[model samples]
Structures are given as structure tokens and as C-alpha cells.
Target: MHSDGNRKATIARHRVRLAACALLAAAAVLAGCERGSQIGAGESTGGPSGCPAVLAGAQAAVSRAEKKEVFWNGPTTGPAAAPGKTIVYVAQTMTNPGVAGAANGVREAARVIGWNVRVIDGGGTPAGIQAAMSQAVAVRPSGIVVGGFDPDSTSQQVSRADAAGIPLVGWHAVAAPGPSRRPELFTNVTTRVEDVAGISARWIIAHSHGRAGVVVITDASIPFARHKSDLIRKELATCSGVELLAYENIPIPDASSRTPQVIASLLSRFRSRWTHSVAINDLYFADAAAAFRAAGEKGSGPPFNIGAGDGDPSAFQRIDDRLYQAATVPEPLSQQGWQIVDEFNRAFSGRPASGYVAPVHITTAGNSDGATTWDPAGYREAYRRIWGK
Candidate 1:
């Protein structure tokens, strides 16, 4: 009787184990089916595929005033420069076209107003930025504009400027989380990064018909790049038919050598599953398109690419040539330069700084036939008028 009872217990335990295994298998199958349903329901407006329509409506709702022509309307009197007053522009790096363009803008505006202006190159390093800031502080310029350098890195120099009654303005230096509220830093002039990401995502979704399998290329080293990447991820989340296969963060230091390998690996892993690629800027996506060509895996149809920030000439050429690059959102660098000087003028004149939002526009093959950057004719005229030039 005891042996029979023991044998029955063993059989009961075996039955329980089998039941558990069956339940596990069923759960796994259900999860996969749910994922597949989301992907296949491309026509459903309530699902991920519905993102394009939502984005379209939102974009259309942008105020007519905001979308209106870019123009300057600051204090008409402008700032009264102190005797022998000079303005200094500290650039993150002259190597970057955007930074260089900004430097030129400062010079142009200063020339119009007849104020002495100087620019210092920071060499794109923390130490270099600190050193440049130190040099500028020692000279005791009327005001200082810093391009693409983190405010925290040069806090000491910024404090010195503040103590000396010189206002400091930052361009592309502050990120989201809040405005430039630091006492030493007056204000930041920058494009709406969130809008740049949102518009680029919307473009991809609309062009791909919402069936986009996207691979995101992000640069974690730069705060603004990460900001753009984060916004892209958030915006794409609303699209049901869009699958995020991967988010690859490539540090700028190793980007030249690592990007190709990273792109090749993504191609190998996802194969033809992915239908689109988005990046922080044209720099990364342009290189990615080249990698696809070199690998001889350039497939025909619909998994195109897009990016944000500087509208590189090479990127425009690629778009015009019908390459994988589809579009780029260009932040008006020269306009920001003019705005930076304008803000400083207001501050010096004891008026509130005019926190200007730089204009951005999408450049594609159709619209950018011969344009590397958006034309600033209207804004330039407006600024000239305000300055009584």
C-alpha cells in the first residue's frame, strides 16, 4: 500500500510540471502574437501606425505667427556702447561649419554697429573652453557670447564676468530641463530642439507610410544630441507600426571608426527588416548611408534616412543625387549669431534680454535644389531696419 501511494505522488508531481510548461509556452506565444498584431495593423488609427496623422494635425496647428517670416523687432534704439567697449565671441570649435558661421555673424553685426568684436576658438575640449573663457575674462569685454560650450565648464570665468558687470550669452550651450537660469549666464539663443526631432520623426513616418522599422543613431557624449534622440524616441512611440529595432549611441571621439562597424552590424542583425534610419545630425546619418553603399547591401525602396542640426552641403548633395538621405532640419546659424548680439545689446541698455528662438526648416531634394541653408533675406532686412543701418 505504501509503495503504491508513493508512486501515485510521483505521477501527480509530473502532471503538475507538464501543466506549468504548457502555460509558459502559451504565454510566450501570446506575447509574440500581440507584437505581430501591432505591427500588422498598419491601417488602424488607434495603433502605432496612427502616429503620422497625429503629427500632421499637430504641425498644422502651429500658430501662423510662429510660422511667419523670421524677423527682428528688438529695441530700435539699440545699445549704447561704452567708450572703447568691445564684444568677444568664444567659439566651441572653428572646425564645425555652424560654429564658424556663427562667428562670422557676430563680426557682421558688430561691423554694422561699429563695435569692436573678437572671436576665440575653444578647440572643442573642456580645458580649451575654460582657457578661452579665462582669456576673454582677462580682456574685460563689454559682453561675451559663447557658442557650443557648456556653461558649467566655465563657471569660474563666467562668475568673473558677472562680477565685472559684463553679461554673458550662450548659443547652443544650454539644454532642456529649464531655461538658462544661472545668475552668471544671461540667456541662451537656440533652435527648438524638440521641434527639430518631432518634425524629423513625422517626416519619416509620413514618407514610410507608418510601416517604418527604424534604427536610431545617437551621440551620448553631447547633451543636445541626447536631447534630440530622447525626443525622437518619445515621438516614435506614438506610432504603432514603427518598430525601434535598436538605439546605437556612438561617442563622438570614436565616431569616425565606429560608425561604419556599427552600421554594418545593424544591417547584419536587422537585415531588411528596418525601413528607416534617424540620427542626431547629418554627420552620423550621412556616414551611415555611405556604409550601406560600401557593404553592397543597398536595397531598393523605402527605408530612407533623415537628420537634424547643421545642413551640411554633402548631405544636400546626397539628397539631390537620390541617395538614402531624405532630409535634414537646418537651424539657422547666422540668424542665431545676429540674435546673440541683439540680446547682448538689450542687456547692456538695461532692458530685458530678448530670448529669441532661431528658425528651423526642413531641407529636402525637392525644396533644396541649390540651397545649403535657408535664406535669411527677410530677417536680415528687419535687423538692418531696427539698427537704423
Candidate 2:
């Protein structure tokens, strides 16, 4: 009787083990289904993409933005240049490549329009910018340019310029690309931030096959940039397979010094999980390149980087060389510069703002044609024709 009871007990234990094993096997199958690239009725499942439609949309948008040959779509008819006018371009910093590029465009347009232009470097500080604005107002130029900085930051100076009836045209001075009333800018020149932000995020989605561990870098100090980063984040969220690993806010001025350390810490933390990076500006990747190299990351990267704005010459070079950066949503810097001068001319003539916003374009080594800058075609001649120069 004792032997029979022991045998029965052993059979019971075997039954329990088999049941548990069956349950675990079932669970493993379910988990695999959750991560598998299988399409069910009205549902998509995949490690790379849980929403195949969203991924497809992103891929299509990226393809559209990556096309070359953006033609001049700016103002073809505007007031002829008010001759012999002197303008002061008060820049946030000459060190900012976008600001400097626009400044150069302004210089070139001024030459064409037979005007004198002077630039004051604000040195990217509040007090310094205020001082520069004060000097700008004191000199009483025909117009003042709020170059690559917020006009509201210098409200007093802006008010002074407004009171003095100095027309203020801005290059990325406000969120949108047209006249600003409260801040009293004649117009703000930039590609629509929504378009830029959308395309940049879509690039990551398409490139990664809808699955990416992304880190976003932005300067929260500037409202425009902060807004841009927010839009990028929102767009990226549409893809369920994409995981935003981190949102990093390093000021543009501090990027060079801080980005390397930040990259090192992030490398240690995320390691292989960190597969892509999107920056509001291209400079962050430029700063992070050496750190990535030190970490033994390939130049052709797992952490593929794309800049949302300000596709400077260096950014193009990085992309062309297949360095740490993969692509950029470039603002047509030279064309916008010419537009600024044209806008100022219209303001001088008491006409309405042109309302011409340049279409957004993306640049990669594949389509850059060995170009350092994404200078759109026909803007120079178009602006000259408008100014009757």
C-alpha cells in the first residue's frame, strides 16, 4: 500500500509540471505574436511597426521631402528697392551659421539693391542683444533685422525700434514665417516649423523601418526651437514601434562643450538601445561626433543623426562624408536672406508683407550633388527682378 501511494504521488507531480510547461509555452507564443510582423484583421503587429499605415505615410512623406530641385517660390513682384537705405542686421550671434548665412544673403541683396548694410553681433546674450539693439536704434538705420533670435526677448528695444518707426524684419524671429503684430516685426522669414518638424521625424521613421530608439536634442532656451522639438516629438509618437529614449535640452551656445559629455553618459546608459538621434540644430551632432568615435561607434552609425533645422555647410559635409549625421531639413538660407531684404523693401514702401514662405526641403548625401549648401535655384535672379536691380 505504501509503494502504490508513493507511485500515485509521483504521477500527480508529473501532471502539475506538464501543465505549467504548457502554460509557459502558450505565453511564449503570445509574446512572439505581439512582436511579430503579422497583419491581422484591422490590426498590424511587428517589432519594427505596430502601425503599418503610419509607417507607410511617413515613408511617402520622406520620399517627397528628399527630392532635389527646389525652385524659387518667393515673391516675384515687390516694390523696387528704396535706394540709398542703410540697414542694421542685429544678429543673435555671428557664430551661428544660420544667422551668418542669412547675414551674408542680406549683404548680397543689399549690394544688388544699392543699399548700405551693417551687422551688429549680439553675442547671443540678453544684455548684449539689448545693447546691440540700443546701438541699432541710436544709429537710426532705415530698418533693423532681428537675426535668428526672439524679438520678444528684447521688448524694450523692439518697442524703441517700433516707436522710432524702424521697420523690423526677422530671420527666424518668430514661430511662423510672416508678419508678427504683438512683437511688431514686419515679417519673420523661415520655412514652416510644422513642415520641417514633420519631415525630420518622418525621416527617422522611414529610415529605421518604423522602429527606432530616438534621442531628441533641442535648446529649450529659444521658444522657436523648443516648439520645433515639441512638434518633432509629437510626430514621432505616431509610430508605435518608435521609442523616444530621451529628450535632451542643451542650449545652442553650450552645445559644443556639453554635448560630448552628454553623449558619453547616454552611450553608457542606453548603449545599443540608442539607435537614432534628432536635433533641432545640426551643431549638436557635430559636437557629439568625437564622443561617438571615442565610444567606438561606427561613423556609419547605429545612432543615425538628423538635424531638424539650419542645415549649415558643415552639416552637408557631415552627411556627404557619411559621418555621424545622415540627413538635414535645410532652410534655404541664401534665398531667405534675399527675401528679408525684399520684405524690408516692401515695408519701406508701405506695402503688405509678401507672405512668401519657402517650401521645406531635405538634404542627404544621396541627393546633395556634392553641394555644401541647399541654396534653392532662381531666388537671386527673382529677387533682383523684383527689386529692379
Top TM-score hit: 2
Residue 179 miss distance in model 1 (angstroms): 6.4
Clash tally, candidates in order:
5, 0
Over 190-257, each residue of candidate 1 has an lDDT whose tens digit, in order, gives 77788778877776666555666888887776677788898998888776767899999985545667
Shift of residue 340 alpha carbon in model 2, Å: 0.3
lDDT of each: 0.69, 0.86
- What's model 1's TM-score? 0.77
Could you estimate the TM-score for every candidate?
0.77, 0.88
Lowest summed lDDT window (length 10), candidate 2: 35-44
Compared with the true structure, model 2 gives a TM-score of: 0.88
Highest-scoring model, lDDT: 2
Per-residue lDDT of 251-277 in model 2, one digit per residue for the tens?
A: 888888999999999999987667779
The window of 10 residues in a row where model 1 has the poorest summed lDDT is: 36-45
Clashing pairs in 2: none
